[model samples]
Target: MPAYDQTRARVEDYFDRTATKTWERLTSDAPVSRIRETVRAGRDRMRDLILSRLPDDLRGARILDAGCGPGVATIALAERGATVVAADISPQLIDIAQLRLPHDLQSQVTFHTGDMLDPKLGQFDAVIAMDSLIYYTASDIGAALAALEPRVSGPIVFTVAPRTPALMAMWYAGKAFPRSDRSPVMIPHAHPKLMSAAKSAGVRRMLRPVDRITSGFYISEAMELRP
Candidate 1:
């Protein structure tokens, strides 16, 4: 397989194995939480931030929740009255996501197990790809953005693992001594490169860090791209 495909497959395997725990880390504040409460707090803040960036009301909007792991945000979008197409690369994650949808709101969400680059997924009024772009390299992100631009009528909101000097050093160290429990690979994306890609794709808009201290390392800036 090609490099990008191989990378994608590895990510699929990682998420598949950790789907349940990942969903808990993202949306729950249980007493026995595995991750830090601050981390969960940050995620909750980021989700609200993305929602705030979207239209005040999403009723009847056709939204694409790219890489919608376990469908936390997918169900949230459906509750807001959006017809959501929640797509994930891992079938295991998709199954978990589908299972989480409320019976009444099940009709509002269509789950698909596929890469975000799939062309036949159709178009949407808006696209949200929260916390999912971290797996891709800069070039892959550019290509994915190019693929998504024409399909979206409104803004594309997504997050990335930012490439700062400190984070770069940590990333290299992690690569040199990777833990078997974590994802096999993690690529920190440069803000400049992301902006360049958006410019090249003719969809450049706004970019800002989600949190000052955690932005460039733990979490990242929320980018809004428009066509």
Candidate 2:
């Protein structure tokens, strides 16, 4: 069997321990390797794209930054005047995010370290999960969306690892030499297949495919589900 086993626990552990510092640095203005620089740039673009889906003047909006690592998107959402609940699986990462947030925006963000689909997160006008679902199976992604759909009155924006020749090769390589220190293997998904999973999960809203971004080792496709 391929050495490819990824679960929520593993992902959380990796982020909380193995990669917290790296992620913190990468998300910051600090310099990084060339490959990481591309990733940073791509993430920035994706964050901006996700934010664009929300209203320009979010004076009273309540948003969820699902699986928010270091709270970059959470910061942006709060800056737009939205009250953001930044939820992450890793408590350590959430702490880092809390520290990184500007003092003025502190009042706008509430940090939660647990499942993003927690009902106690209350509801949201919109949600964005950038690169958070890329490591999970299609079915899991679908179930997550299903859980979020009822609570969100607006759009549920997210990203996935699109199945492409290059990404497929990377997936295989990951299976061949998986390690705990590395990021979890990203499950590649075809748009049609993902949409089918979403449908199966009772998410009635159509999964609208947006732009696919590729920068060095980073590849993710953004989509939005609106009510």
Return the top candidate by TM-score: 2
Candidates' TM-scores? 0.85, 0.95
| Candidate 2 residue 214 C-alpha distance from true site, Å | 0.9
- Please write out the lDDT profile of model 1 over residues 128-226, one tens digit for every residue: 888777777767777677778888888888887767776678778777764675665567777788777656655555544443226323555577776
What is the alpha-carbon lDDT of model 1 when measured against the actual structure? 0.75
Could you report the Cα RMSD, in angstroms, for every candidate shown? 2.9, 2.8
Q: lDDT per model, in order?
A: 0.75, 0.88
* Clashes (candidate 2): 0
Give candidate 2 misplaced runs (Cα > 4 Å).
1-6
Candidate 2, which ten residues in sequence have the lowest lDDT sum? 1-10
Task: Look at candidate 2 and tell me the lDDT of residue 135.
Answer: 85
lDDT of 2 at 165: 100
How does residue 177 of candidate 2 score in lDDT?
Answer: 72
